[model samples]
Target: MKIGLYFGSFNPIHIGHLVIANHIAEYSDLDEIWFVVTPHNPFKKKSSLLDNYHRLEMVYRATKDYKKLKPSDIEFSLPQPNYTINTLVYLQEKHPGHAFSLIMGEDNLKSFHKWKNYEIILENHHIYVYPRVTKETTETQFDGHEKIHHIKAPIMEISSTFIRKAIKEGKNVKPLFPENVWEYLDEMNFYK
Candidate 1:
């Protein structure tokens, strides 16, 4: 199976994320797209994040209907401030029968070099880059590289941060996320 890992904090899984994942699964050769809910990202502010389990549950609720789209808690058991390289290495070792690829947006590519063992990741796994609404489709030095593929997926300007802000401001964000996710948020009184 060709599994593409879509890693994120998912502070709350929003439509933008689902759109990208669905697009990659439907349009690309990947057999499955797993939304790897990271427990903690080294680069992101820890204070801004919700509880890891809450984030994971939101992902599960959001992606439950799609057979090809699944949520993963792989990073939860891993070390804190998880790095992509470590997770990829562990996954490769465990799932030798399956092929894995990295799914990311163009914004991540801009700072790809700063990631831990990024060169090793590029050499060992394929990267599918999707366009982000706010980012320009500028060519990176590795744009034409064999391991890096730029896919033209539909871009949504919405973000988890935006959704959180809207919710906190007493704005109805029902249309920004999957139905189950919004219901969970409402029941839990999240971001309010």
Candidate 2:
């Protein structure tokens, strides 16, 4: 099975995320798209994140209906300050039968050179980059890059940070998340 690892700290999984995952499953040859819920992202500050379990629950709730889209708490058990390289290595060892690839945004392509052992990852695995609102799918940005394949999915401007702010400000987050997904958050008082 070819699994596309879409890693994120889904503070509260939103509709945009669901859309992208569904898009990939339908368009790509990937057998599954795993939402590798990170306990902590080294690039982003710890203050912006919510509890790992709560965030994982939100992801589970949001992705439960879709079989092709699934949530992974793999990082929850692993050490803190999660790095993509380490997670990939762990996953590879755990699921030896499955072929894993990266599912990221085109923006990350710019910083790919700076990632830890990025060349090794590139050589061994494929990276499918979808168009982000800020990142363009242009040749000029990347000079004939072959490892990076462009995924044509809807570019949702909604971000977890923006949604978190709305919830903190006592605004209705019902529309931000999938049906009942926000209800789960409300019941748990996740953001509060």
Candidate 3:
């Protein structure tokens, strides 16, 4: 099986996340798209993130109806500051016969070189790059890389950070993400 690993913090899985995954699953050659919810990102500040379980729960609730999309807690059991290379190695060892690819935005591609063992990841796995609000591309870095596929998936400017800020300001976020997730956030009073 060719699985596209959409790794993220998923502070709160929103519509943008869902749309991108759906686009990849439908348009790309990937059989499945897994939302690998990272417990903590090495490049990001941990203080602003919600609990790992809470974020995982939100991902689950949002992707419940999508058969091809799944919420993964693989990073939770791993060491803190989950790195892509380590997770990929662990996953390959655990799940034999399954080929793993990476799903990321153009923004991440801009800083791909900064990631640990990025060259190893590029050589071993396919990377599906989708457009984001800001069109930052690392074309020079991966100009002739056949493993890197540029997808014309629709880009959504909506972000989890914006959603959290809006929710904190008592603005309506129901339209931004799945209704179930919005309800869960409302009930839990998250980001308030």
Question: Estimated TM-score per prediction?
Answer: 0.97, 0.93, 0.96
Residues 1-192 of candidate 3 have per-residue lDDT tens digits of: 999999998888899999999999999999999999988888889999999889999999999999899999998999886799999999999998999999999888888989999999998999999987764434657866899999999988988889889888988778887888888888888999
Instruction: Please write out the lDDT profile of model 1 over residues 1-192, one tens digit for every residue.
Output: 999999999999998899889999999999999999988788888998899999999999989899899999999899887799999989999999988999988988888988899999998999999987663556677877999988899977888888889999999889988888989999999989
Residue 134 accuracy (lDDT) in model 2? 69
Clash totals, every prediction: 0, 0, 0
Q: Arrange candidates by TM-score, descending.
A: 1, 3, 2
Off by over 4 Å in 3: 135-138
Say which prediction, candidate 1 or candidate 2, comes out ahead on TM-score: 1
Q: Which 10 successive residues of model 3 have the least lDDT summed?
A: 134-143
Q: Give Cα-based local distance difference scores for all models.
A: 0.91, 0.85, 0.90
In Å, residue 69's CA in model 2 sits off its true spot by 0.6
Better of 2 and 3 by TM-score: 3
Residue 185 of model 1 has an lDDT of 93
